[model samples]
Target: MTETLRPPASVRLVRIGEEHAGQRIDNFLLTQLKGVPKSHIYRILRTGQVRLNGGRIDAARRIASGDLVRIPPLQVAARTDEPPSGAVDAFAERLTPRILIDDSELLVINKPAGIAVHGGSGLVLGIIEGVRKLRPEARYLELVHRLDRDTSGCLVIAKKRSALRSLHEQFRENAVKKVYTALVTGAWNQKMRTVDAALDKNVLQGGERMVKASAAGKAAATTFRRLRAFQTATLVAAEPHTGRTHQIRVHAQFMGHPIAGDERYGLSERNRAFRQQGLRRLFLHASRLTFVHPGSGRTLTVEAPLDAELQSFLERCP
Candidate 1:
């Protein structure tokens, strides 16, 4: 159903909902006033044109449910192009089978490798955007966390603002449990389980991010437990204590046993050998996640089974 959206000629009042509570005012405005320039949004906020509960609030102020939001009149541009027919239907069809868990507050999907979590950096549509396009009826949807394009596993999405805030807090406090399975070159001893290293992030000329072990960087740690052993490779479960960029992959490299098929950090020789062994993508999969349900207040553990290709490649590993 297409509803006409007219620019408010004067100040407009918006009532916050359960799905939008605890979100910053600026972010809320960005979604509500789509296509409006960021500069204009901030200008209105800076000029005290935007208010929360009858009081002027900063852009970072979190608005709660039932809070009255004052938004000044603003123009929204018209769209130039419409999506092709059945585009959203086709996208939803492709993504529906990947859903592992879906509730009013949370969405968990077994994300496949080679697909980004969200669109950016030259890509048009990503998992989140695709979901939004497909589920036009959804009032609120946002990514709770991110996984690399090459990483496949249980990725979580928040269906409500409360869930998002709660999940973010859990991640920040390291209360959420995330476990990944990776095939790495060389035999890993059970004794070498923990890797305490500092990681520094750098941006390349092309705007790609590169993370390395550095003393001056943020603290990162990973605990690896050997799960299986091949002649020249080992399958291990990696648990990252700190959510730094590429922490698990970088820690695997630091241990002299880079993950197989990790093009960014793996040795070319081992990668070529793995490729010959039928490894087509990075051999890292988010196997399990444990956390408290934001809505239920109960501990929940979700698991994603290994993809067919990864299992096939493991079988080929001699």
Candidate 2:
């Protein structure tokens, strides 16, 4: 049987809470109006059907504690396909053991490969959602940064709005130190320690996003240090100076040493060879992160060792 749900016929004035202070208005509305289409939420926002403190506000405006949000009438369709409670519990259970750091203001985890940081693009759940389920008591939890779904390692989550803002400032100022471990095709030249290139991001006709080195693009740089050498590849530590979409991967490709098992921006022949040797995923891992502890104001570092699959593949490399 099809069922329909509708919001109140009259406008609502909701007072923002401290927990939601730093969140964008659109996101706050999504939480308040569950089951409403994201497009609908943005449409009302653009047309000023939504207002902040009796004034029209844009989607990007951050809400503050005690601010009044005026919501117009909304019609929402009931969702029948919510995942079962058991499934959500199982997902949270699997992630609990992967946590590397937990405190009053921060949570760090060794994010597993194949799980997106947040749900979108046809995925119903991601690391952030799972964490929410894991710690339902948390009033606020937000991703401090993002890692590609195929890359496994240290990921940070902020538990307070202040922490999120501070961490974001640190990232924007390039004060955070991130180190990644990657296996690239061919022997890395000892003296070739850096790749300074500009990358342009583009979406193809089929909707596949790609980044390539271009003369007119965002400036990016990555410092590379060879860690280990094998018969067909070299393991290197890559520290990106500027964070851009797929910066390290594109920089490695620009230097003629694309990461092994990287289907995008990589050599098909080399990928096939690595696959035959049991490399099933991209040979990239965010090995470590160093930043100021947002709550304590102390230097902190978190590390995640390579997973067994990656370790075993390295052992097999001649």
Candidate 3:
């Protein structure tokens, strides 16, 4: 339930470093506040609750190192103790059999390709909720990074917010290594190739997400190495350099090898062919991720193998 009256959350200013001095207000807020809902900040900006130099300023205004900002008070909701939904319970049950690795600071899993990382739409709760219920003493676990709802593979979860922050920094700086495996349509003659494409987003009527090639979009680049070529499909190992939304999937489509069973940006004929071969979900999985540990500063690497369906599909592919 929404709080009828919100008291106030204090705002403070920390001088930006030389590198971030001219960042926009919204960007600065996102960096500092971390978890505040975007809509709430946009509303605050619209009402002129955020100020610069003792006067209201646009949310897009670039903030420099010495600039002062005043933020009005707000009623922040208390954290609730509601139990997660029944689906989360089911998802938790599934996760119990699928956990690949775990540690004091993290939970690593090979998420099946079809299941979402978390809940939405009609979903009551996500993996985190299920994980929490399963390991109740694991009070502070959080996702270090997100894999797509339909894409499967190794997913990282931080045990605490500090660890989460450190990991987020690592991702932001592109210091982590991520590798995805997929069955793409067509026989790729290129043993190795790099595809660079920009992504532009379009939101559907029911909030279905789509992306396209556009100059106005972020620079997305991915490198692919063909591991094995089937008669009609190729299994490729993909390494994305810049983590734009749907970068790997879009780049694969650009190569005319839309991942088999991928609904978005995939050819229906290829999808049908994949289904004929007994694939149910998109033929993609995050197989591995390597990074320096947030707490120990040691290099930490994790891998999730293809589930039974993918393993069987590869075996049958001629």
> Which candidate ranks first by TM-score, i.e. highest?
2
Candidate 1 wrong stretches, greater than 4 Å? 1-88
- In the range 1-318, model 3's lDDT, one tens digit per residue, is 111122235554344443344445765564444345545665676678877767787664666656666666655443353354775576678788878777777778777665555443344455656787778887666666677778888888777656766676778778999999988999899999988888876655544567887888878889999999889989999999977778889888887889988899899987887888798888888998999887789998888888888999999988
**Compared with the true structure, what per-residue lDDT tens digits does model 2 show for residues 1-318?**
111223356777787776676666876776778777655677788789998888999775777778888889886767665679898899889998899999999999999988888654445678988999999999888887789889999999999889987887788779999999999999997844888999988756544668999988889999999999998899999999998889999999999999998998899999999999999999899999999998889999999999889999999999
Descending-TM-score candidate ranking:
2, 1, 3
Q: Which lDDT values do the candidates have, in the order given? A: 0.83, 0.86, 0.74
TM-score of each: 0.77, 0.80, 0.75
Which model scores highest in lDDT? 2
Return whichever of 1 and 3 wins on TM-score.
1
Question: For residues 1-318, could you state the per-residue lDDT of candidate 1 as single tens digits?
Answer: 112234367667788776676666876786677666655676788779998777888765777778888888787766444346587467667888888998899999999899887543344456887778666888879887789999999999888867999997898789999999999999887744899999988756544568999999889999999889999999999999899989999999999999999999999998998888888899999999999999999999999999999999888888
Residue pairs in candidate 3 whose N, alpha carbon or C atoms collide under 3 angstroms: 6-75, 8-74
What TM-score does candidate 2 reach?
Answer: 0.80
**Which residue segments of model 3 deviate by more than 4 Å?**
1-90
What stretches of model 2 exceed 4 Å from their correct place?
A: 1-81
Q: List the residue pairs that clash in candidate 1.
A: none
lDDT of candidate 1 at residue 292, scale 0 to 100 = 99
After superposition on all CA atoms, what RMSD does each candidate show versus the true structure? 6.4, 5.9, 6.8
